[model samples]
Target chain A: MTTSVNPLWRFRGVAGTAWFAMVYLYLPILILIVLSFNANKVATIWSGFSLQWYSVVLDNPNIMRAAKNSLIIASCATVVSTVFATLAALAMSGPTFRGQSVINAMLGLPLLAPEIVTAVASLLFFLAIGMELGLLSVLVAHVVFCIPFAYMPIRARLEGMDPRYKEAASDLYATPWATFWRITLPLLMPGVVSGAMLAFIISLDDFVITFFVAGAGATTLPVYIFGMIRMGITPEVNAISAMMLLVSILFVILSWLVGRVKQ
Target chain B: MLSASVRRTGLLAPTVITLFVFMVLPMGLMAWMSFLEPGTYGGVQWGHYSAKSYIQFLYEWDLDDQLVLNTDYVGIFLRSFLLAGGATLATLLIGFPTALYIALKDEKARNRWILLISIPFWTNLLVRTFAWMLLLRNGGLAEQFLSSIGLVKEELNILYTPTAVAIGLVYSFLPFMILPIYTSLEKMDWKLVEAAFDLGANRWMAFRRVILPLAMPGIVAGCMLVLIPALGSYFIPELLGGGKSLMIGNLIQNQFGASRNWPFGAALSFALLTVVMVTMIAYNLRFKRAPGADK
Candidate 1:
């Protein structure tokens, strides 16, 4: 950590800009969080503090319904996608198979394609097959993109895992299935949990695709918040946004922490 | 005993089937829809194939049935490009230094800085844009602060403008730019820069000659990550750009909603897809050609 190693730290404005950039990123979030507690209806004004906005958000039946929908969709998508992604990760991390590269590309497509395009495509596909547009459709679509988020951590964990435990288990006459159950799966649990947390947050936070796919009676929290913001900015919207932001941050930090577990 | 290959296939089948049914097939359907004629009452008419959707990007049939050069869609695409391009440039300017600053930190501080950057990245895009709306809107924090500081005598009036959209894009994607560049810089051999300095090079020369080239891959990747999402961004423009500052995402949404031209909407999506694919392919080629890149 000598100065000679990276003299660029002394470069004028680099450190200054870094600090400014941090402020730029977090200042508005802080303001929003603070204003969520304001008694004033107007979001801009700094009226006396109150938790009335949170209470109002809770009391609103429409917001409550949307929150319920978001939780259901996120839970279902997280479970299904995490299970499927774990399987895929286990397979790909095993002996090399034919068509591995093709499968890799296919797995990456959802991340590469723009969400708007994916939304439009999913809408057309649903319409073409005459599928009903509802929460089911939203749930199906959520699983598609969530696969990659769920796959990444599990795959990383598999790569980092020592092979010696499985080797030892086999040398002791343990069946392959028994070895996997006793050794591999237990070791991969942290990554699976991390991936599930990530996928859950992503499904919860999604607005663009859910906006297009969700029909009547299928509104999610983000879609509801988007509608509220379009109507006007109120402390209620600020309160709801702050809540969603906090949930995402909590899940993300937990995901990071779980992924960092060594054993 | 089950063979390993059988076990692998069994394990992989669920994800493969899910992606094929949900992701690949839907995209295929979209491509097919783009070729079919538009239905009068929304959706597309099967078996009524036509090239009109793609053609309509540049020309529209006039009253006399003659094709006329229409710039409406083209203009929107251009504006989107300009705004997204501006955002990429701005993020690079701000993000590079920020990334370097983080990379220069000790391991403990580095992790903390990255976490700070990533929290905003993983947070909801809609909420982030809404945060900007609260800041940049008239009589909002930006206006109030600027006027309070005597920097401007009147309302800032920055929100609901392209500038506001640009700001939202830059802010939302800045972390995307920083994280990749920081990854590359953190793994870089600092001794190379020291070597350059020892060889009678100044700070600028060392950076320009040694450090920049080493960081090219991450910079390129960062630019792609920022540009692609910003280009197709829907909510940022909708919340911040108002009615007048329409981007291609809004334009596509309009075709699907108000205009009732599903074919045209599908076509516009394809157009956007083409641009993204080209950018990615170009990046892949450059990356593969880079020295020491694995095949």
Candidate 2:
């Protein structure tokens, strides 16, 4: 602990500030989670712990439809983006080629561009092309933004991988396709899985772009929750928010774990 | 068996096509839409070039159809800039210490702290903003707690104000600030700090001269990350500001949704994009990254 030498003088209140900051960060989330289980109709008041709110969420037809839409969109977005990202990562992993920097910048553009801008642009694009703004439009938008998220982890994983294994396989007269299948793919699975998980969560949790692009009958969970929130808070909103938080947190942790696992 | 170059081309095709069609093409269309006349109903009028959308940012047509300077849209842009700037500063003040504390920790504890920080970031932005809505509303937890503690008699009346929106922005983007600063500080060479101390530099001096310069790259990155999103945030200002305070985002949405002015909305997006790009380019030029800090 070299830092212990000046802890008292140098970073006087930093540790305390970190503690306070953590509490500040988690308190609202914790309160929301706890209140989600409250038996009372009012969201803030506590009568007793109850599972009725969760049941109410499950029973609500609008929420269920939104949830179904969310899952379908997230799944399709995750699969498509991850596959495209995996292909891009595989190609870009080999060597620096002409226009590599340009390609890299383009890939990151979706991430760097403001969501509101992208949403507005996408809305205009769909309208200009005479494409109906529905599930398909939202899906197209999700896959676009999600590609960079899916690409980054996979690219990182490939960068960390020992390339000699693939070389050694190819040197043994194994075909390029065989070497990719037998050697590279297994090595990249963790990155691929983690990337897919990240894409899924991002798509599932998206609000801004989805809100703009989604037309009638194409509401996702976050969009539905936003509407619910606008209408006013209820115990049901809390429950659904809690559940959504759980899903995202679980996936993040799972992605972290997968990222840490030995390749 | 495919050649490596052939495989590269094949593998890269999807990404190129997807980005070109969806990202580049849409952005181009938006740029064009920003110049075209807005349609009566909603969309833009094709081939009708008009700079009125851009001009309308500072000027509006009066009864005589003459351009008159209007600060309404500019006011929203200014408010958004100030709010985003304030949020960036707040996050830095809070996040720097948090990041420094984590960076000082040993490996196991460091990982735990990082994960804790990341969870909130990965969580839904709407949910996080909504949580603030619960706390800041009239008679909500914050106000109730203040009253319960005999702090005040009157209502807090913080919700639906710019202050509430500021709080949400700081809270939502704190992690973005922390993570980048942590990334930089984590890779810092602590020996530099020790050398400064050994050379008779006091704690504050060491921090100012040695530690801060090293963390500059991260700080800059964190500021950009926070500023950009904070500038464009719709939900935080919408739900928290209660429509009293309008940021660039809500203003743009209003143009599209209720005002039915697609060209103006697209123009606002371009204006926002220009601000963002200028910030990014200026920062990149000013802050030459510390060598090996990323490693």
Clash totals for all models, in order?
Answer: 0, 0
TM for candidate 1 is: 0.97
Task: Place model 1 in a CAPRI quality band.
Answer: medium
Off by over 4 Å in 2: A1-10, A258-263, B1-3, B288-290, B293-295
Which stretch of 10 consecutive residues in model 1 chain B shows the poorest summed lDDT?
B286-295
DockQ, every prediction: 0.74, 0.71
Name the runs in model 1 displaced over 4 angstroms.
A1-9, A256-263, B292-295
What is candidate 1's lDDT per residue for B1-295, written digit by digit as tens?
A: 7888888899999999999999999888888889999999898889999999999999999999999999988999999999999999999999999998888878888899999999997888898789888899889988888889899898888888899999999999999999889988877888888888789988889889987988887798899999999999998898899965389999989888889999999999988988998888888877957863323
> What lDDT does each candidate get?
0.90, 0.89
TM-score of each: 0.97, 0.97
lDDT of 2 by residue, B34-89 (tens): 99998899887889998989999999999999999899888899999999999999
Number of backbone clashes in candidate 1: 0
For this target, which candidate reaches the highest lDDT against the unseen true structure? Answer: 1
